[model samples]
Each structure stands twice: as C-alpha cells, then as structure tokens.
Target: MSDRRLTPELLLGAYAAGVFPMAETRDASEIFWVDPERRGILPLDGFRMSRSLARRMRSGRFRATLDRSFPQVLDGCADRDETWINGTIRDLMLDLHALGPAHSFEVWEGEKLAGGMYGIALGGAFFGESMFSRVTDGSKMVLAAALDHLRRCGFTLFDTQFLTPHLASLGGVEITRAAYRARLARALADRASIDAIAMDGDLQAVVQRMTHTS
Candidate 1:
C-alpha cells in the first residue's frame, strides 16, 4: 500500500490484526506491511539490569520522562545512516502521538537529550518502535524507565518487533509468530492505561522500582 495514504486508523487496524506498517527506505513513499516469522518481545517481569547499569541508575546521573519530547524522539530514531522511518511514517507517528496511540520515554542528562524510546500502545500491548542514545547508559536508562512504566500501567506485552543483541542483554527474547499471536491476543483482550501511571523523571526512583519488582 502507499505510505502517503496510510492513515492513523488504517495503521491502528493493521496493528490490531498483528501486522505493522513500514517503509523500505528513508526515501520510500510507499509503506508495506510486515509480519516477520520471528517476533521480538521483552518479558514484563524479566527486564534485566546489569550490576553496572544499576549502579549508574543509582548514581542519578540521568533523568527519565514520558511523552516529553515525542517528535524529538522520533526524529532521533530516524537520524541514522540507514532507517526505515521515512517522512510519511514520521508524520503518521507524530499524528499518533497527538492522538495518544504513540508515546515516548526520554532520558536527559542535565539539559541535554541523552537518550529516549518511542512506541505505539494498544490495550495491554506496547509496540516498541525505536530508541536512540547520545551518551553512555542513556538508552539503557530509557529502556529501564519504559519497562517500569509499562509494568505500572498494567501492560502485559512489550513487543520489540525484532530482537537485537542490545535488547537481548536486557531480557528481550525471540518467539515464533504463532506464540507471538497468542500473547498478542491476550494483551489486546485486556484493558490497560498507558498514561494511568505517572512518572516523575526520576532515574533513581525508576531504578529502585524496577529492582524491587524484578
């Protein structure tokens, strides 16, 4: 289908049906649907924080916030050598953010944007789209904060779409499409509020909660 013509309603419907929209390249105007054979997911109760990362979080060098810079997070994710986020996708995401279908979690080191993550949320399922980091432990801090937020909001499924070494280290795992669909079904069936829980942009508090729950 044409990416330029993909509306927020169509994209939401697609996600509800267990597929997602994507562009082939940064310059591509046509968007395509994708349902990979393998899916990447993070266990809500298994998000791992290494000892060193825990120390960093305890050090309070960074702060985390949610939906603070939705557009900036999307732009940062696309600011790379190779990206599937084209102009159409970027605009759609921004629209989704405004409509509350998309949300972002950002980590700031003082006044600088250290790192952040953004994604789409439906029911109890959160589809992680992308993340970016500009300083050490920046991305990790965002991920931890996001997971904590998701858990507090009663979300059950954290869909990464694809697994990477970076995600795997933090409890991301690959699952077959069939298994993924089962989880997705359960997640969609349940009701959860992505914004029900409030975060204070406190990195240490986030870490303490994650450690206590995990």
Candidate 2:
C-alpha cells in the first residue's frame, strides 16, 4: 500500500511532473502514481468532429457550459461499474476544485444533465480526468465543445493520460515518455485559463469552426 498522503498541493505537483494517481478499484484505499511509457494526448487543434457529431452539435437539442456543475459531473464519471476514482481521489479533486485549478464542462439536454467532463488545468495543459454520458452522443458533443473551448482559451496541450479506442476515434494520440515530457514542458512554460474565453455562444459556431479546421 502507498504510504503517501495525497494533498491538493501534492496532486498539483504530480500533474506538473507529468504523472497522475489512480486506484486499483473504486474502493481501493491507496492511490498510485502513473507515469506511462506512452502517454495519450488529444491535440487542442486536432479534435475531429465527425459528421454525426457535427450534426448533433448543430441540432440545438443540447446546450454546453463550463464549470456549471462540477460535483455532478464528477459523480457521473464515477458512477460507472469500474472506476479508478476512489474516495480519496474524489475528495482531493474536490479540494483542487475549491482551490481554483480544476474545472468541469457540462452538456445539458433541456433540464437534464446529459453528459460532461472534468479535468485539471495547469499552465496551458488540460489533463482530462474523466467523462460520462447518459444520452446518445452526449459525451461526443461534450468532447467537441471542450476541445473548442480549450483552443479558444489558448490552451496548447490536452492530456488524456492513456489512449482508448473511443479517444483515438476523436483524435487522441500516444507519444513516448520523452516526447510527452517535451510537450509538457512547453505547455507548462505557457499559461492559460479555462474561463479566459466565454463559452456562451451558438453551438453552431463550434460546429462551423471544426468543419473548417478538422
């Protein structure tokens, strides 16, 4: 078992070092740091909005917002059957949120919270921690909006920790540890904020921008 006690300060330091903590299971008592040989990252300017995602974004059936309901978004992500977000990690993330470096991007379907994601933002890097969806295409739309927001906010790096099939489909790529550190150093040298740009605009604008760029 890890003897290290995770504090908000330590958590931030770990992220700065390009490592993150995870638990073996949702109920695990200890958290271990991960410094993967291959790191997954989504390029801020390279996120792909497929035809269906673009259509859904312009559908006007969903609305997106940032930091609207952070705790709710965290809960949604942790609600899955298998998760690494143990109690210790969850509470510490809450502490980080209160300290101002953590944020959530949410997608809503009318009165219901459809999907969202939460992550830690440091310098120009956004470490995507977790995401969840309750409706079809909910998570996809949220990702599209989140990437758009990141770019508009001047963020340069979007760290996904590890690549998954879903993320690869959306443009997440893996880099060797040495390569990732080079990118991370550059991102850390720069500064950015999630709220630097207002996320209050027509969702179609995001779709249009992605159509041109992606």
Candidate 3:
C-alpha cells in the first residue's frame, strides 16, 4: 500500500494506480484507501437517456458548466447524512482542483444550483468521485453533459468506483478488479485532448451524440 499522505499529487498518483481514498463519515479525521474487488464504470458509449430523461434535457430547462462552483458541488455531495467526504478529503479536492486534473460539471436552473459532479482526470481516464442533485433529474443531466464532454475530450475510461441504483440507471456496470486495472493501465498509457471539451457545456449536443456513439 502507498503512504496515503492525502496530498493533491499523492491522490492523483493513487488514482493513476487504480486506488482511491475515502472516510467513514463527514466528521472523521482519518482517510482510508479503497480498492474494490468489482469496480463500477459507465461505458463512454453506453449512457442511457430514457424518453422522460430525454424530454427533460430537450426542454432546455437547465444549463450546465464545467469547473464552475466546484466547492459548491463538493459541498452538495457531502451534504447528505453519513458521507465519506471528511475535512481532509475536502481539502484535497480543493487542492487538486487548484493544481488541475480535478473538475466539476455544474447544472443550474436559472440562478439556483440544481445539480453537479466532480472528479479527477489523467490521460484518457476519469475518476468520478461524487455527484448531487437538488431537483429531479438534475444529477442525470450533469452526468449526460459530463459524458459528452469526456467523449469530446478524448477520455475513454469513466470510473465510478462503486455501483448504485442511480448509476445503474445511467448504464453503470461492474467489472472485476483485474479487468478494471487492465482498462486503467490502457487508459493511462493513452493520451486524450482535454482541451477538446472547451467551456461551452451544451446538453442538447451531448444528447444528440449519445445515440450515435452506441
């Protein structure tokens, strides 16, 4: 096992090696390493946009942005009860964002923060840490937009770490640790143009490409 120093660079290094850190609770001071037996990932070309979800996205009811309000997004994800985002982890997120590699996809309805997500990216790999939603389908919208951005940015592996019903609804799947590490190594060996994502953050365009990709 690594030293688990919890610095921004150390965290990135850990992610590159296919492990991540978490805490038992929001108030916990210590962080622990997590390398699950089965890793959860959403196939870049297999995101689902059901009729109802499609309808909401097409309606243009919300807007999305990247690297905007990162702290808020992190806070939102940690707002729930029994969160793993302790103060140390939160500081690491802030530090990582400042040093680059960490990013957020924020969704807003008018001036209100509706939903958002944050994660880390390296080469062609992206580690989706957490997400939150204040309104219905908000997190899904953020995810759809994120996938499009990732695809455009040339990212190939979207690691979710764990599977949940919410993630399953969006085509998240579990793979053996060995298979996941294989994919991770491949992704780390490749290069992806992060600049291709730009700052536009358009949802309709994302939805349009989703059907064509898979």
TM-scores of all predicted structures? 0.96, 0.96, 0.95
lDDT for each residue of candidate 2 in 61-82, tens digit (9 for 90 to 100): 8898998899999999999889
Model 2 whole-model lDDT (C-alpha atoms): 0.90
lDDT tens digits by residue: candidate 3, 1-214: 2224667888888999899999888877698899999999999888988978878877787888998899999999999977999888888898889988888999888889899999998999989999999999999999998888888788899999999988998899999999999999999987885567485556676777887776
Candidate 1 residues lying further than 4 Å off, grouped into runs, are: none
Question: Model 1 Cα displacement at 203 (Å)?
Answer: 1.5
Can you write out model 1's per-residue Cα lDDT over 1-214, one digit (the tens) per residue?
A: 2355778988899888789878888998777889989999999888899888889888877888889899999999999999989888898898899998999999988888999899999999999999999988888889998988888899999999999999999999999999999999999998999878787678788778888888
Specify the poorest-scoring 10-residue window by lDDT in model 3: 1-10
Error of 2 at 147 (Å): 0.6
lDDT (CA) for every model shown?
0.89, 0.90, 0.88
What does the lDDT come to for candidate 1? 0.89
Question: How large is the C-alpha RMSD of every model relative to the true structure?
Answer: 1.5, 1.8, 2.5
> Least accurate stretch of 10 residues (summed lDDT) in model 1?
1-10
After aligning candidate 2 to the native by TM-score, how far in Å is the CA of 173 from where it should be? 0.7
- Candidate 3 regions exceeding 4 Å error are 1-5
After the best TM-score superposition of candidate 2, give how far the Cα of residue 88 lies from its true spot, in angstroms: 0.4
